[model samples]
Target: MLVQDAKNLVIERGGVLNCLGPKLGARFDYDADLRPLFPLIKGNLANAQLYDRPERVQFLLDGILCTIYAQEVVAAPFLERDQVLRFIHRLTATLNDLYTRRHSLGRNHRKTTMLPVYDIYRLLPGTNCTACGQPSCLAFAAALSRGRSYPDRCPGFRQPIAHHAVYPVYDQNGNLVSTLEMELAADADELNRQAQPTREHPAVALLTAREEEVLRLLAKGASNPEIAVALAISPHTVKTHVGHLFDKLGVNDRTQAAVWAHTHHYL
Candidate 1:
């Protein structure tokens, strides 16, 4: 199992939730090395959001916010301790399932962005459609931008698919500060407006299917021989793949390649 247990579950500032009627934010520390699963979750789950640097992953499910890190998991707005415990149990099972099926899932390491409220507003039907339970399209747009609502809420909304666009934010030293990610509408006008953001990062060269498999295994600390055996390939072929990975990733050795995979959330 990827995550055997979640320990130290506790409510944080339980009283602040009084107005919200006993809603609780619970956190628990764990021992799982979930870095390798980040890419799998991000690429496979349509609703999940991922970030690097400190490595945080989050998704909204059933109106609950579940945030995961390398060593801990947090879920919020539960009614009681039992609810939190049940959530933790379900989350642990889900993580374990994701890890078990990691080999079959696709991987994506692209940066994510937060869309502006107005941009989100443009994607809606703009009919002042209160069918989504919101008074106005602008109000619904605000909820969508804040991750408090989803695009499917609007019945007249034609395109509900998420389109990811990355815009790198840099500081004066040209060091990357953050990457802005947004779900774009299919409209051409939306794309034109989105093009205004500065994109400093060059397009990343994607890895082939076999190369991705090899990299994932390598990141999991598998030796070359183990990778060869797992992939049913010759040792010489595995060595060649490793060499290619080193060259493509601009890394010197296997350890460096593994580090790169982790940093980029490829693992």
Candidate 2:
């Protein structure tokens, strides 16, 4: 593996990230020189930004912000201890993959800037889908430009992708900044409905908002009582919601419900 150990794990608390959904971030210090892998990362990730001066690459993965410096890696929105381990594993695997294939990949040194917020907003589904936890598409776009958000956070970018097509954007310096995958020729009304928070998944329309919340908690391995406490509801109500969720999702048990939630991205 390119990065085997993180010498230290630093957490940022009550910091700037509180406004961005999480109150903490994770910083991993490593001994590997990540400079050579920047080109491979830039070519792979949609929002990768490589800087030559400091030798770093910043990108988004699974809605989490990641930055790879020459000898360190930082991931944010505060992952749990287990989540941090998984993140490190994935990070190591990604870096190792890039290192192993570096010979076949072309190297690039061009510096690219982030696309304008308006430009990103224009590419969004324009549904004001708050599923990304942002209030609006414009707000999400601004967050994305600042590397605080990712495009896939938009439900419009997540589900029912009937077709795929690349939409390229160039920086002010005429350099290709992003080649985002945009849904093409999709039914507008369906996309809008799916983008709605209460109906993020195609099957979610069959479940109530409370049931959806319960299902998500269950998928996280929360017990009925735990879910009740988390949702500020009674245990009986939580059970009822779980039952309704199972029925609506066509599942027989909690395990099946959890599997369904995961299969439909409710988790």
Candidate 3:
């Protein structure tokens, strides 16, 4: 029933819904047909299809795997089949509500307004420091898509001479929508200051004192194997802790986390 509902919903939204063969590896292709409706929608449903598998739902719920893709919810590698169905039911309801509201507003709410980083890189310090908690230049670009952060928090982009620039609009399906005027620097700065630090761990506030010590050791050049020996835990256990640390830190790489720890005096 869940699968059928999902298929129907996808079609109702004008999305192409095809069941992938096993050899395709749980892949689906939500093409440009749904572009205008969900501007953030990107290419191929490769990651989104992972939710169809029963064993990966826990990862989805924990945000360990894909969370939301193309506006569809996905799970990770250990979710049960029944759980996936339930998720679909909940998702469908939420989407229905959203669609109703959007209809009333006479606009597609899934469309996201974005600013390209290249046009504004000149206003940014271009340090790629991850001080804002993102790893690379492109990662920052992606974040800007959400309008959560601004170019000036970069410290380098705070120069007075930098000109403001606007990015082209896109739908959730990664389809081009329209171009918007560049955001004023004044507005951008206000938004940046209001941006909260990305939650590293959803289950806790920052790291615990013990976790901080472990992270400090990691920043100071301790390998997972070495950390395990120092903390008197098995290497596998160290790996688990490290995984948690990465999520808590919202870091994609250990080096970035290390840099953050050093810059913020976590080390």
Q: Pick the candidate with the highest lDDT.
A: 2
Quick one: ranking by lDDT, best first? 2, 1, 3
| TM-score of each prediction | 0.44, 0.40, 0.38
Provide C-alpha RMSD values for all models, in order.
20.5, 15.5, 13.3
TM-score of predicted structure 3: 0.38
Higher-scoring candidate on TM-score, 2 or 3: 2
lDDT of 3 by residue, 1-267 (tens): 112245422211101122111111111222212223232112222222112112111122223233343434323222344544455565445434544454443441222344444434433456788776566554555455335456544554333322445444445576655544444437755765645554432322334444566688898989989987897767876676677566544455576566446534565
Better model by lDDT: candidate 1 vs candidate 3:
1
Question: What local distance difference test score does each model get?
Answer: 0.62, 0.63, 0.44
- Weakest 10 consecutive residues, lDDT, candidate 3? 11-20
Clashes of each: 5, 0, 27
* Deviation in Å, model 3, residue 73 alpha carbon: 6.0
**Ranking by TM-score, best first?**
1, 2, 3
Which residue runs of candidate 1 sit more than 4 Å off their true CA positions? 13-21, 114-185, 188-267
lDDT (Cα, tens digit) per residue for candidate 2, span 64-95: 66777788776755446677677777777877
Deviation in Å, model 2, residue 171 alpha carbon: 24
Off by over 4 Å in 2: 16-21, 113-267
